[model samples]
Target: MQDHQSGHQRLTLSDVQRPEYLANPYPLYHRLREHDPIYWDEEMHAWVLTRYTDVVAVLRDPRFSSAWGPVETAWMPEELRPQLEPALRAVSRQMLFLDPPDHSRLRGLVARAFTPRMVESLRPRVQRLVDELLDAVQDQGEMEFVADFAYPLPAIVIAEMLGVPPEDRSQFIVWTQDFGRLLDGGHLSFEELLTTLSGIADFLAYFRRQIAQRRTAPRDDLLQALILAEEQGDRLNEEELLGNCVLLLAAGHGTTTHLLGNGLYALLQHPEQLQLLRENPSLAPTAVMELLRYDSPVQLTSRRLTADVEWAGRRFKAGEEVLTVLGAANHDPEQFPDPDRLDLRRTDNRHVAFGHGPHFCLGAPLARLEAEVAFTTILRRLPQLCLATEQIERLPSLVFRGIKALPVTFASVLPATGATAAAED
Candidate 1:
């Protein structure tokens, strides 16, 4: 509960993990944005940026590099270094952690497959998946939203997009959960680090098999597209290919899942906003944007300084780490008036929920389409939907914000005619 008013010098990232802050961190975010926009946490040894302008500046500035490998492992204990080396090596190549020419090259190749037209073409299928998912639980008066709907919708969509067999979809649910824990940038217990590494190993292995199969028998899916993607005779190398594929799968679904859960929970909490969305279905697009702004799934992203620079009157040295608190930035009062309030029709959002600049989420279009379809479909189908319990458990990672489980009750509704058949097709 340390705050600027309490004479605390600085608030550590660990402070946000307390039950109260974990459930709702906006209050803390407000305090940071207002009093300590540029804070240096002695524990994390990183400068924390909470103000909207500062966060956006760091994200767009090339001086703040995205290459996190050296920063992440520099202080690691020698004993745990070897244990995490393999995982670190794989992550270092992923586009998310690369900088400049490497990131630009990798992103360009992948962008070809994720064009807006490509994502739009999948709407029908995404809609069908949403219908089928809801139809399964429509008969029951209650269901776990995260397990039944939120997780599967995007997971299946991304898996299908990658041409993964339906049977293999279940495995990713487990793998991605483990991979997510590694993204938090917090100190991990030895056991936790080992578990994350195991998941990373398995995920890369699975993609390796897919890559091999696609090399011989190419299909008309993203995996095959990625395999064949070329630019000026430059193609993704073996490790880069596998690393980015794993990134696509993990990032593709994990954040979208949280968007659905967090967005829905936000709507439910603000019943007026929920009613507004339900009444005016056309507001789906704006409503989705507002939801993303209100409670971003990805709360924080880190960057290592490429060169010494003075920003916001503070001189930061080269190689220093900076953590941009996106959640806090999204709610900055200077940027979004009455920032804490949920307004579905709010405009000029320009929120960094999916991030900003080159490292902006490549899967953003697809995520938005999936959420638009989901929120619209949920409201249309489950008119009586209400939280089964007020007590909800949020995922532990500070990097990703999400509800671990969301049990809800609603009046049972039968499947729409042919909805089940269409989904199965």
Candidate 2:
């Protein structure tokens, strides 16, 4: 275990990558927030903001740009820069990486399909999927939570929404895993970069074919809606359409998978909280919110300063990069009372688990719905569920926090005759 305070008074980004920190980063975040709330990380070539106030301020500030084209290639090796062009181009068009008017334009076109009402309409389908997934392992008495339950629910939901063939849903796991690596604060090795780019290439190609098919024969799906979406004669171009579709697919499932894994792990650790939730399933909404605050799936987000500014007692120049530590902000003691404790009933919880301001997560409602359904159904169906092993592995990424796999045991229940029947009722 590395000492939280050793010789140096200030913590660096390398300290964040320590094995212990990766498993549980809140302690490290506490140290960072306490000692250097707005510190410059020499390794990352960016300012790291850990305080809740600072994170919220930066996120809502218009001066900080989300555009990635200028920021992505800044740290790349000169030789590899050319190799990264295609990947960068694809990312530049993504709503996640763009700022208005592009961000506004793209989001306006896609927001209709993800509105609260629209997402709520997905509850029945999500519930059915959750029940079916649990039904598959209900007889096993044990299962890997991530593979058995967490990953598939949202993945299948998003795939079906995009009109992706059911058979093609499995391939997204590989593509998303590869794409997620690129967001891990650029710690990729030479080989890893190539693999990520290849995976992205394949993802785009696959979607290109889908888009072409939608063009020829329209369907009543989100993808086709995007294809036909027009705002005052403005429409998504080929690159924008491809980039956003891939973004939706990856972002849709990846964060939710982590949320479920992290949320369940947190609950299992705090058995009292788990039991509290079990006794009062009505707490599902607040419980999910608390879980998000306790250990956010997307830990960090970056922004580029558009102009020189003095804030948080520091001067930031135009074009300087800033990394807002969302996970840390979510755990800030000032904002969240008993920040580390798992309280299913925590209220007025305005955690940035889905972010804030214009760039807040588009799929938040869908993710929350999926989680609410999954947690409620899992507790109801699987009696006496408990961790099968204390040993657990976390995904190797700083920006995204998640369990690689969670094995658990439960008293097996008889399989349901009809998974959707209860949902319909």
Q: Which candidate wins on TM-score?
A: 2
lDDT of each: 0.85, 0.85
Model 1 error, position 287 (Å): 0.1
lDDT of 2 by residue, 1-425 (tens): 12234465547755667789877888988887887788888777888889999999999898999887553566556776665655667767899988888899899988998999999988888887877788788778999999888998888999999898867878999989887887777677877787787788788889889988877888899898887763224567766887888899999999999999999999899989989998999999999998999999998999999999999678999999999999999999999898988889999899999999999999999999898888877887888899999989887777888998999999885555464685667
TM-score of each: 0.92, 0.93
| Global fold similarity of model 1 (TM-score) | 0.92
Clashing pairs in 1: none
Q: Flag regions of model 2 displaced more than 4 Å.
A: 1-5, 8-10, 70-87, 230-233, 414-422
Worst 10 residues of 2 by lDDT: 1-10
Evaluated against the true structure, the overall lDDT of model 2 is 0.85
Error of 1 at 284 (Å): 0.1
lDDT per residue as tens, model 1, 1-425: 12344374456666788898999999988877667789777777888889999999889998899886553666556776665565667767899989989999889888976899999888889988888898898778888999899998998988898888766778988888877877888788977877787788788888888878777887898788778763124667766777788888889899999999999999989989999998998899999999999999999999988889888778889989999999999999899999999999899899999999989999999999999989987887887889999999998777999999999988875455554356445
